[model samples]
Target chain A: MTADDPVRDSLERFIGKPMGEGAVAPEEVNLPMIRHWVDALDDRNPIYLDEAVAAETRMGGVVAPPAMLQTWTMPSPVIAGIAERGGAPTAMKSENVVTALDAAGYVGTLATNSELEFERYLRVGDRLKTTSALESISPRKRTGLGLGYFVTWITTYWAGEDEIVGRQLFRIFKFDPSTMGGAA
Target chain B: MSAGTIHVGDELPVFELPVTSTVIVAGAIASRDFMPAHHDSEYARGQGAPDMFMNILTTNGYVSKFITDWAGPEAMVKKIAIRLGGPAIPGQPLRFSGQVIAAEDKNDERVFEVTIRAANDLGDHATGTVVVSLPLEPSS
Candidate 1:
């Protein structure tokens, strides 16, 4: 059996569970911040650049680009087991397959697929509450060509009075490049 | 935005990084993320940019570590969101940093509001908000 195979609970338990939630505190977003994200992606979507142009569209005031929220970081205090509590890890027991591969000494990995869903446009001042859940964890299967592993996490983002976004799902594969990709 | 762990308008320790592709890939491996946009410059540039771009998850890692590093590992990152403004190209210098804006205590959690950005020569490429839970320091 491949090391990617599930050993304990399904890999689903190892990642993507909700940590907690917070609020936007009303009218909190500053337009400049929105512009910063837009400029970074180099996306020429005019609605984001010009407010009048943005108003012409359904979303008002240069709404945040769908993928923007995913790029930001969460409030994680560096010290462990001191200031806070770990209710449940976004990760599960079986989800360790990927980490396990590295632990067991597997060398390389490859990415296979990803899916993201945007339920509503993220507004500037809207209060956002993010809730997450572990989606799935599949055992790493050894293919005739090589070996790889896969896992997914589901996050639901909510804004004040609206369900703004849903599901940022990610997946990956691991293999010895020397055997498959022919690399050192 | 808060007097907790940070004051309003303080530039953080630039999420302390070279923002390298290795860091990006480490995040992908941790999450088992496989998106052509993250790993392949060819696929990434085919869509846009001069080369492959860092994944949002990797960006999040730096961002997460940035604050957590300050708050200490024990702190919990309740929620975070980033808006991708520019691409974090591989082999270039980038900064992951932010400032505290507000603080609240709810359900025994010391909630902090922070505005963070990943800045580079290209200007700020990413910006977002963070909500963290931290331990309280005993009054002297």
Candidate 2:
């Protein structure tokens, strides 16, 4: 897709736009959620579960995994319901770009890459907030999946007021999966 | 795990994850990723995916868990950068492995950079780097 493409034009309007007004986590960093995550992954880390072990360590207390940064700020189901019910404005999200592309015949999407940088580990009780901005939208390119464009966004996770705990550079491809048959 | 003992070529411990459909769906929900492609097998197949695949959020959690499992709980992750190449499909076990590429002494702590990869039969599912800081041992 090029600048001349209507779908591309719609997506271009989102470039540099912040995702949502500012996403504040509905819950604070806590052990229950962290436990759920570790359990799901079957992670047997003593510091994450055993308080005594954590006390002996330098961290002095249990801390949420840095990778959980995005989890804390994920859009809650209630919030999604509100948006679906038209009770709230559509938050600035990359999904909007996908919806626009889907309407233009690009119905398939897949995450291609992600880069995360964490400044520090998040401790229990800490709250998180996130803001994302569309970084770039690539021109149409051929790939194993099909003809598509790559959309990139930068999301920063914040703790408390101003401290940036982590940042994720995420990219996904919007494409026509049917074209895969012709790809090598 | 002492940071001082790590070397540039040292290999991180390998981990195997037995992926299951239930786990895939549960992980998606836990991560608040309600994407149909991650839970509904039919929806995934419709999208040309073999079956419901692991979402990036779940992949990120697994990657971090693998690193911390080797680095020990005391070690704090400073960064992780990953690129997804293949779909982590259910019924295929995902194997995770890594090697220490660099280690440095920063202030009173030791930091190690590990190059890591997660793979399945299809090929590398994800590859990335993680920077972790190991606490300094108390002076005796």
Candidate 3:
């Protein structure tokens, strides 16, 4: 239950620090991705694509699905050898807490929570950028999967000269699979 | 489904999604999440997942749709907070259900908190609260 290792001591330094540099959206909010999401999920919300219907509603125009907030800034992937890199969209940077945890033997990652808050709906042509900060890291504890630490981070999405658009607080459990002895 | 009509404890219509590789892969690609466990079954098995599963963005999308489908287009989602569990794998249909847990009047809008759960045979894939608002009608 105690996380008194040197690695744990090092991790505490990351709390409240920037995870990395801010990332700009590869593409501005556009119709294509919205349409794709609508068809893929079978979501028929007229406000998402039907401009005429949306114009009559309170929105006054088509707005991207609020949940698509995170998609705008996803790093473009390198298709080849992605699985070998453990499904990371790009090569891992050595300085972040995630890489540090993996290096310290907490090799399994499980997403446990997501809290998304939108300040305003997004319109087409709105470009987004995200800045993330490490919020907290819990001490080692026993979980259903094994022994792990709970890592939480907050990402803020911004658009058009410092106007806040939304925010997401995401949490993951990074555990050591080899520690699954009796729990397994 | 106007601001005047919504009440605490009101249930939203149930929605059932037929999970499939197509669903999983389409959502993953649309969200630009290229993680292999969401698109490659063999890779997922190697990672110890039952199969390629639904990604979190897709789950949030479905959760958003479920609320808007019932609350109508005028509703705006303010927040969606959920705790994830179990995998939403192919061949199992994920059933979506929800209820208005609290409702209050804010300036120019009526805010409502909805508790939702998306479950399949494996177990509850996601469970949490979504906060949404609808414009209040102007006084005549």
Maximum-DockQ candidate: 3
Model 3: per-residue Cα lDDT at residue A99: 84
**Two-chain DockQ for each candidate model:** 0.03, 0.50, 0.72
Q: For every candidate, how close is chain A to the native chain A in TM-score?
A: 0.60, 0.81, 0.95
Candidate 3 to native Cα RMSD, angstroms: 1.9
Compared to the true structure, candidate 2 yields what TM-score? 0.87
Ranking by lDDT: 3, 2, 1
What does the lDDT come to for candidate 3?
0.93
TM-score of each: 0.43, 0.87, 0.97
Q: What are the per-residue Cα lDDT tens digits for candidate 3 across A11-53?
A: 9878999888778999999999999999988889999999998
What's candidate 1's i-RMS value?
A: 17.6
Cα lDDT tens digits, model 2, B30-116, are: 776666777778877865689989988899888888888777777888888898889999999999999998888888888898999
Ordered by DockQ, highest first, the candidates read 3, 2, 1
Superior by TM-score: candidate 2 or candidate 3: 3
| DockQ value for model 3 | 0.72
Model 2 chain A worst lDDT run, 10 consecutive residues = A83-92
- Candidate 1 lDDT tens digits, A1-184: 3443454244445555542343233234446655655444333455445777666443445665444454332333233332122212232244245565555545454434434455554656655655655566566456533655544545565665666554555555555433653322
lDDT of 1 at A13: 51
